[model samples]
Target: MTFQLRVLLVLAPILLPLRSSISQESAPTTTPLHRIVPQTPAELRELFRYTATRLPIVSAHRGGAGPGYPENCIATFEHTLAETFSMLEIDPRMTRDGHVVLHHDATLDRTTTGTGKLADKTLAELKQLRLKDSEGNVTDYQIPTLDEALRWAKGKTILVLDQKDVPLETRVGKISQHKAEAYAMMIVGSFKDVVACHRLNRDIMMEVMIPSHAKVQAFDALGVPWQNVIAFLGHVPPTDPSLYEAVHQKGASTMIGTSRNLDRVFHRRVRDAPDSLRRDYQMILGRGADVIETDLPREIGRLLYAPLSKSPLGHRLLRVE
Candidate 1:
């Protein structure tokens, strides 16, 4: 045998193993994605159903908009889902061309590079502009249509569609068109809207404001089943604990938002008194809130990640990969 051939043969096995090891070590690492994906409308309803042993959930306001992530952007939704198993709250507005897009304001100057009334812009025009993060920093992401958001959220997370310029019938139509009854719910302004939504699609659930006992009685009078809703208790915790029981007794879960109130405290103390902020969040859940809608879902998710991962409800509805 030639000398070179003999040397190559001798080194072949060792070189091959080292090459394999290096390949294994250098392969891209995939961060485990955490998500809440319900497969059916019934499953979705069950996830929000109140129970003594139910695990608390987070609802991301504006898809958890933050540094480097623009509100109402699909990338931001995925970014938040990567950290925690939470439902996303999105805003849907109508464009001049009659296309439904996810946007929070009537004007685009505040959240995008564009500087006009959103209603004056066509979807094509809006698509040409990039979205800005909460800090007013521009991002690479473009505005996603409600259709795009609905398709993207199928097995990743639930989207709570906040009513913007879009009519209730249109929103309901979009949800039905997407067959998104399993993963999409809407926020209705009143008992009339609630009844309208229920009439439109019984399979689709809603987030309705039922913060007061009088409203609760009005809601109950509608004869719409509690399974059709996740009651929103406004921007702060209700002073009456019985209000919680009233809803819970009807087999519905309750959601309280911190984006306006407690979330301000959290952001202010994010550097100094974070632990106290966490305790305050825990206290909200302690007061019978099944869900906390917050601008800082990632923070609440960090606090909930461990226990929720082990809870029965989490095991059934949450996906970690």
Candidate 2:
């Protein structure tokens, strides 16, 4: 071959890899929400710990009930995950025939076209009812089951299962059956429930009510690893801010409920004011909360992602030392 031909061949291998690398870099990729979730318990623990320092986890209250999508419906979940890195707070209730389904209210009158108590209906009966939005307008979405929700959340956002009326055994059974311990967590009300859930599945993550330091100690006493716990401090602004620190020392994170404060008397000054809302969020973050469970996850996520100067509060987010 001539010298010119040999030179062209020498450049081909080098140029090809460079072009391929550029093409891969330029291609659009899925966001963290759409990517496969953490499969191990240790990875999930690190996710929470790292996220606390980065951005506070935004949990959509009632799966983010709004205009088109109804609360606890699959459509709402998909919409939220597509928009942001969010955790869906869903209520699980049992049907009359023992199927676990998602519905916020004990009765179906407020959120669905159906009437009477939700427990009185079977899965088939629940499926027949169309869901309603916050405005009470009927939508085409049907009630989703725990199984469906778990499966859907497998590779998407994390799910915070509010143990509304479902028994611990039922919830644990579903989580295990779906192999969803990495992406699913249940809001346990009592120590008994926490112990029961831990005993059933050692890797099952739990969100427990920890109103005070004593409660934190109680949880520690249970001998369940703190790595699997996220402390829920309730709707009221915590009276003891140190509880956040205390819990952190135990290798767990804390979640503050801002949804209830939206209507409470103490929060009246900040309830309607945009600036005050931002300040309130800053205060919560300053207090060392790792997650903010809100009725307005979309709005909060937007605000949290904004720069410190552009944030409505006009201040930087407080970091836990």
Q: At residue 130, what lDDT does model 2 achieve? A: 100
In order, candidate lDDTs are 0.82, 0.72
Residue 132 lDDT, candidate 2, scale 0-100: 95
TM-score against truth, every candidate: 0.88, 0.80
Q: Per-residue lDDT for 170 in model 2?
A: 86
Q: Please give the TM-score that candidate 2 achieves against the real structure.
A: 0.80
Summarize candidate 1's per-residue lDDT along 93-190 as a digit string, tens digits.
99999999999999999999999899999999999999998789998889999999999988888999999889999999999999999999999998
Model 2 worst lDDT window (10 residues): 19-28
The model with the greatest TM-score is 1
Predictions: Cα RMSD each: 14.0, 14.1
Deviation of model 1 at 119, angstroms: 0.4
The digit string of per-residue lDDT tens for model 2 on 1-321 reads: 532233223222321112111112211224223232566666677666523333466788988776776899887776655444568899999999999999999999999999999999999999999999767899998999999999888767678888888888888889899988888988898999898899999988998898898898888899888888888887875856688889888878889888887423323443345455445566677677778887766555544542322334221222111
Note the residue pairs that clash in candidate 2: none
RMSD of 1: 14.0
